[model samples]
Target: MRDKIESSLESAIFNSRWLLAPFYLLLILGILALFVKMLKEVAGLFHILMTGEGNLIIAILGMVDVTLVANLLLIVVFSGYENFISKLDVAHNSVDKPSWMGKVSYADLKLKLIGSIVAISAIDLLKAFVNIQSTDQTQLAWQIGIHLTFVVSGVLFAVMDRIAFGGKH
Candidate 1:
């Protein structure tokens, strides 16, 4: 009876990974929301083109930032699901399956996530610089500081991952 109870407890614990499924599903919804935002940004770009008043580079940067964030969410959804929840068995035979889908270990996911953040931060900083005429000097300083922090954090994450994985990734 004790052995049976223990077995049942372990089974329940293992099945709890499914609880994360709802979170991943929510991420998909977040991606859809981002799509709407990207469309709005595109419309803004068109307005700028028609009026020739807004800075094209800044508008372009806004779109790029949105795209990067969307990509980050997608990476998290796919890799996090595979790493924590279950295999995306439906994509196993799909020709459009991402190359990194099944292979991104948790460590790899961490690295990729940080890398994406750093890239997004850099783009935002670039936008600030491109609009330097109106950008607040103090805010620009903070942006630079924040971007550098991200860059340094990403480097440290990579180094530690290398040490932990013996340079295998």
Candidate 2:
């Protein structure tokens, strides 16, 4: 009777992981919202270009930033689902499937996440520099500090992951 109870408890705990499924679905909703935001940004960029008023390069940078974030979300959604929930049973020869979908381990996911954040931060810093004349000195300093923090954190994460995984990932 004790063994049966223990087995039932273990099963319940393991099945609790399904609770995260809804959270991943919410990430998909966020991705959809980001797509809408990207479309709006594109429309604004075209308007700025047509008016020949605002800085076009900065506008382009904004679009790039949004795109990077969306890509990050996609990576997280795909990798998190596969790693934490269950393996996605895609056709081996399906061209539409991403090459790295099933291959990203949890460590790989962390690395990818940090790398994407660094890229996004760099883009934001570049945008700040492009608009330096209007940007406050304190704000710029804070941005630089935050970006450097992200860079350092990413490097540390990679180094630790390499040590832990023997660089296999």
| Best candidate (score: lDDT) | 1
lDDT accuracy of residue 43 in candidate 2: 91
Q: Which ten residues in a row have the lowest lDDT in candidate 2?
A: 84-93
Runs of candidate 2 with Cα error greater than 4 angstroms are none
lDDT of 1 by residue, 49-138 (tens): 999989889999999999999999999999998998888899888999989889999988988999999999999999999989999999
Against the reference, the lDDT scores of all candidates come to: 0.94, 0.92
In candidate 1 the C-alpha lDDT for residue 137 amounts to 97
Candidate 1 stretches with Cα past 4 Å from truth are: none
The positional error of residue 158 in candidate 1, measured at the CA in angstroms, is 0.7
Residue pairs with backbone atoms closer than 3 Å in model 1 (clashes) = none
lDDT of 1 at 27: 96
For 27-83, candidate 2 gives per-residue lDDT tens digits of 999999999999998998999978998989998998999999999999998899889
